[model samples]
Target: MQVSPIGTFFGDAVYKYEAPRQGRLFAGHPGRIELNAGQNFEMALRDLDGFERIWVIFQFHENVGWRPTTRPPVPPKGKDRVGTFASRSPYRPNPIGLSCVRLLKIDGLTLYVDEADLLNGTPVLDIKPYIPMADAFPDAKAGWVEEQEGDLWTVLADAPFDAQNRWIAERSDFDLESFARVQLSRGNFSKGVFDSTRRRLTVDESAHTGVLAYRTFRIHFTYDDTARVVCLQRVSSGYTAEELQEGTEDKYGDKQLHRDFITLPDFRR
Candidate 1:
C-alpha cells in the first residue's frame, strides 16, 4: 500500500490544537488547497467548480500514535469514556481525516474552500464532490452522540469586548473573538465538562466569571446560569510590549497596516 499527497491545505490554523473540532462548527477562515503542478491536476478539476461542496480526504500528519480509547470533548457530563472509533479522535489507527468543505471557487489547480477544519500544510490525499442525495442522512441515528443534549449556547461580544479583540488582532495574528466564540459556544462551564487531568475551563466563585486560556491570551467571560448565554467581557494578551512590538512585524506585517486597519472609521465603530 502506498499513498502520496496530491495537495497541501493552507489556512490560518497553523497548529493542530487551534483547528476547530469539526467542519461547519467554528470554521471562520477560508483555506486554499493547491494541488501539485505538472501532474495534469488542472485538467482533473475541470467540472469540480459546479459542486457546492466537496469531500476532502486528508492525513492527520501531526498525530504521532494511536489510542484504543479516548475521551471526546463534547460527551455527556458523566459518560465521557468511549472507544476511539466511536469518537472523531485524531489518534486513529490510520491517521486519516475527512471533512466536507464548501467549495468557494477554483483557480486552475488551486481550490478555495470554506468551513475547513484542517490545519495549514495538511496533506490532502484525495478530493471528491459531495452529492446531497447520496451524502446526506438527516434522519439517521448518531448513536451516543444523539444521547447528549449538545445544545450550543449563544456567544456575543459586547462593544468594549469587540474593541479589545480588534486591538489584539492588530497586534497579533490571532483571532480572539472567533476563538472565544468557539470555546464558549460549547456551553460547558461546569467542572465535569473536561477531564479532571486536563482542566480547560475555570470558574471564579468570587467574581462569578469563567476563564478560558488560549496560548498567551486569557478570555474573560461570564456565563449566565439561567439564561445560558456566554457574554465575552474582554481578551487580555499576556504578550509584553516588546513581544507585541516584535509580533507586529512578523505575524501581523507592517505596523502601519494594522494602525490603518484599526483607525478605519468602520473598524472603530
Candidate 2:
C-alpha cells in the first residue's frame, strides 16, 4: 500500500516504447532521469558509470484501473480477460511500471540511456542495475505476446519541438508532415486497417489540435483524415482525445520547455 513519485523524466522528448514484451525489446531510444525539486539527482548517479543496463521502476501515471480480462495488441482480437497481473497493460490498479533499459552514458545527472520504453515525464520510482542471470527467463512462455506482430521499441524522434514556441506564440498553422514522417519511421502507427485509414486522414481544425500530456509539447496532426491531431497524451491506463488536448495546452508554453534540447548537447563532459 506504499506509493510515491519517482524522479521526473527528461530527454530529447517523451517517447513511446510501442510493443515491448519486456525491457529487452528495445536496445535504443535513450532517456534520462532528473530530480524534481529537492533531491541531489547528480550524486545518486555518480557511481553508476560502469553498468550497462538498469531497471527503471516508474508510475503508470496514465493507467486507471485493472480488469480481470483484457486483450493484448497481439493477434486474435477477442480473448478471455485474464488476471490483471498476468498482462503488461498499464491499467493495473497500482499503475506501477518496470523496465530494464541499457545505460549508454551518464553526464552529471543526465543519463544517456537506450531501450527506454517510457512516456515523457514518467515519474521514476527507482533505478537498479540489471543482472541478466537473475532477470531473464529464456524459456519464458509468452501467453499471448508470441503471436503479436510488432516490436514496441522501434522508435524515432518525431513531434518536433523546434517550432513549438512559434506555434504557442503565433497560434498559427503548423504542419505535421515532417513530424509524422519521423514518427512513421519509428513505427508509431500499427500496420492494420485502422492505421491505414488513420494515417491517410487529414485535419484542419483548431479545437482538435492540442499539446501532449505530461511534458512541454503540442502536436496537432490529422488522423484518419477527420481533422484531429493524433493524440500524444501520456498516461498509464490510456487517454481521452479531450484529455490529451487539454494537457498539451495547459503545460508546454515557454522557453524552458525547449531548454533541454539545447543544453544537454553541450554538457556532455
Candidate 3:
C-alpha cells in the first residue's frame, strides 16, 4: 500500500530544534494546513470547526531512517534509552506522527491550528477531530515517566531578555523566548530535555550561564539549579560586525534582519 499527503503545514518552526516538545508548550504559535486545492477536501472538512481540537496526522519529512530504540527527554534511571514505539522520536520506521493541535478556524482549503509542534512545510496525511470523551484516558500508566521523578522546570525571561525578545518578534517571525523555554525547561545544562550537546550551545555550568544558538541569533541565559528556574538574560546576533556589513554574502537571505537587529538600542551590548 502507498500513502499520499492531503495537505501541508506551514509555520515558523523551520528547524527540528525549533519544534517544542509538545504543542501545548507554546500555545501562541499557530500554523495553517493547506489541503490539496482540488481534492474536494473542503467537503471532508465540513463540521470540523465544531471541534475545539484536532489530531493532525503528519509526516516527519526531515527525519531519515529508523531507530529500534530512542532516547527520551527524561530517560529512566539506569537507562538512557527506550523502545522506539514507546517514545515519540521522529526517527521511526513509518516517519508518521500524530499531533493534537487546537483548531482556531477554517477558511477555504486552509485549517488554522494553534500550538503546533510540527515544522514548516510538514506534509499532513489526515485530520481527525478530538473527542475528549473517547480520547481521554487520564489514569493511563506511562511506563518510564511514572517511575522517574517529575522533571519540569519553570522558564522565564529577564527584563532585558523580554524586551529583546519582543523587539525581535516585532521585526521577524522568530520567537526565541518560547524556543528557549521548550528547550531549557526540561533539563539542566549538563543534561537537557533536548540534549545540550547535540544543539548549538555553550554551557558554563559553574556560572550557571549558557548560550543557545537559535538560527542566526544567540540566547544568553542563567539557571538556578536549586529552584529549577531558567531565566533568559538576553539575545545576541550570531553574526559578526563584518558579516552584517553591506558587502557580505546573504546566504540565508537574513542579513538585513541582522543589520536591523544591531540597531535595537544595543540591547544585548
Candidate 4:
C-alpha cells in the first residue's frame, strides 16, 4: 500500500515541544491546510464546510525513529513508562498522526482550522469530517488516561506578567505564554513537582518561587500551595552580558534572534 500527501499544514508550532499535547487543549493559534489544486482536491472538499470539525491525518515529518516503550513528559511519578500504543508518543513505528481540529472556514483550496496540534509544514495525508454521532464516546473507559485526570492545575498571569510576555513575543521566536501554560498546567507544584533529573523546573521553598528554563530564558513564577495556581512573575534571559556583547549567534546559533531578545528593555531590567 502507498500513501501520498494531499496537502500541508502550516502553523506557528515550528518545534514539536511548542505544540499543545492535544488539539482540544490548544489555546487558539489557527492554521491552514492548503490542498493541492492540481490533484482535484477541491472536488473532494465540497460539502465539508458544514462540518464543525475535521480529522487531519498527517505525517510526523521531524521524527526519525521509534521506541517500543517511552517515558512521557508529564507522567505520574511511579507510572512513568508506558507502551507506545497506550500513549500519544510521537515516536512510533509509523510516523503518522491524527488530530481533530475545529474547522473555522474554507477558502478555495485552503482550510482554516483552529485548535490544531500539527507542526508547521506537516504533510497532510488525508482529511475526514468529524461526525459527532459516530465519534462521541462520553462514557467510554479511557484506562490509564482516566487515572491521569484531576491532575490539571490552573495558571493565572497578572497584568505585569502579561506585559512581560508581550515584550518577549516581540523580541523572540518563542511563545512564552503558551510554554508557561503547557508546563505549569498539570504539574503537582504544591508538593514540589521539580524533576531534578530533567532540570525542567526548580522550586525554591525559601522564596516560594519556581523557575522554568525555556531555551535561553528563565521563567520566574510563584505557585500557590493552597490555590494550586501558578502566577507568572517575570522572564529573564540566560545569556550573560559578555555573551550578549560578543554575540549569542556563535554560542546559541540564532545570533540575530538572540540579539533581538537580549536588547529588549525588559531584558535589560
lDDT per residue (tens digit) for residues 105-190 in model 4: 99999999998988999999999999999998999987677655236668888776688778768766667777778667775764
- Would you estimate the TM-scores of all the predictions? 0.84, 0.53, 0.93, 0.85
Error of 4 at 239 (Å): 2.2
Q: For residues 1-269, could you state the per-residue lDDT of candidate 3 as single tens digits?
A: 89999999999889887888678766777899999988888899999989999999999999899999987767787788999998888899989999999999999999999989999999999999999999989998888867653368888888888888898899788889877877777765555445654457788878889899999999998888889888899888899998888978989888888777778675744
What is the lDDT of every predicted structure here? 0.76, 0.50, 0.85, 0.78
RMSD in Å for candidate 2, one decimal? 11.0
> If both were scored by TM-score, which would come out higher, candidate 2 or candidate 4?
4
In each prediction, how many residue pairs overlap at the backbone (N, C-alpha, C within less than 3 A)? 0, 19, 0, 1
Clashing pairs in 3: none
Q: Give lDDT: candidate 4, residue 66.
A: 98
Worst 10 residues of 2 by lDDT: 232-241
Clashing pairs in 4: 249-255
Candidate 1: tens digits of C-alpha lDDT, residues 56-175: 999999889999988776785468678889888889999999999999999988999988889999999999999999999999988888766446778887777788677767666778
CA displacement after TM-score superposition, residue 194 of candidate 2 (Å)? 6.4
Residues 1-269 of candidate 2 have per-residue lDDT tens digits of 67666476654333342323343543444567765555776667776888888888888776567666655444433443445677776777777888878888876666677666676688888888877789879899977656444333222233443334333334422223232333333222223312322233223334433222222233443332232225432111123335344335534343332333233443111
**Candidate 1, position 10, lDDT:** 95
lDDT for 4 in candidate 1 is 97
